[model samples]
Target: MLNQIIELVADELNLDSKTLTKETRLQEDLNVDSLDVVELVMKLEEEFNIEVTDEQAASLKTIEDILNFVEANK
Candidate 1:
């Protein structure tokens, strides 16, 4: 699941797949801005068949945060 999310984000952001990892910063390393984060989250929800509340979404600060959310909700 983590690998899948990384691939999705990498594809969406036009980033090199090798550059993304557990410790990679979404904003700094992936260059994801606010809009990108929203879009990515939406993509994730679609992919995972889950919904992320706005407050929960706002709290996502890392790749692990996303993975944990998806795991917990699904």
Candidate 2:
């Protein structure tokens, strides 16, 4: 699940998945802007078949945050 999330995020951001770590920040470390995050959430929803609420989306600050959310919701 973590690997899938990393791959999904990397694809969304056009980055190398190997470069991302659990500590990587979605905005600061990955350089993802607000619009990118929205798109990322949409993609994640589509990929995982789960809906992430606005509050949940807002809480996804790091790679670990995303992994935890997917793990809990998936």
Candidate 3:
């Protein structure tokens, strides 16, 4: 599941998957701005068939956060 999420995000961000890790910060490491995060959240929702609350989206500081959220909610 983690790998799948990585692939999904990598594809969405047009990033090299090799550069991503659980510790990678979407904003700090990937340079993902607010708009990018918003779109990514939408993609994640569609991919995982889960709803991410605004609070949860704000708290997703790292790749692991996303993984954990999806694991818990999906």
Candidate 4:
């Protein structure tokens, strides 16, 4: 699941997978802005088949947060 999430985010963001980790901050570390967050959440919803609320998306500050959300919600 971690690898899948990393690959999904890396491909979506056009980033190297090696640079991504659980601690990677979406905004600061990866330059993910509000639009990116929205887009990412959309992709995540598609890939994971789970809905992400706007508030939940806002609370995702790191890769670990996303992983946890999917793990719990899925």
- Best candidate according to lDDT: 4
Q: Which lDDT tens digits does candidate 4 get at residues 1-74? A: 99899998999899999989989999888989889999999999999999999999999999999999999999
Candidate 4: RMSD to truth: 0.6
Q: Is candidate 2 or candidate 4 better by TM-score?
A: 4
Q: Write the per-residue lDDT of candidate 3 for residues 1-74, one digit (tens) a residue.
A: 98998998999999999989999899899999888889999999999999998888999999999999999999
Give the Cα lDDT of each candidate: 0.84, 0.91, 0.93, 0.94
TM-score order, best first, reads 4, 3, 2, 1
Worst 10 residues of 3 by lDDT: 30-39
Clashing pairs in 2: none
How far in Å is the alpha carbon of 27 misplaced in model 3? 0.9
TM accuracy, model 4: 0.97
Candidate 1 or 4, higher TM-score?
4
Task: Please list all clashing residue pairs in model 3, or write none if there are none.
Answer: none
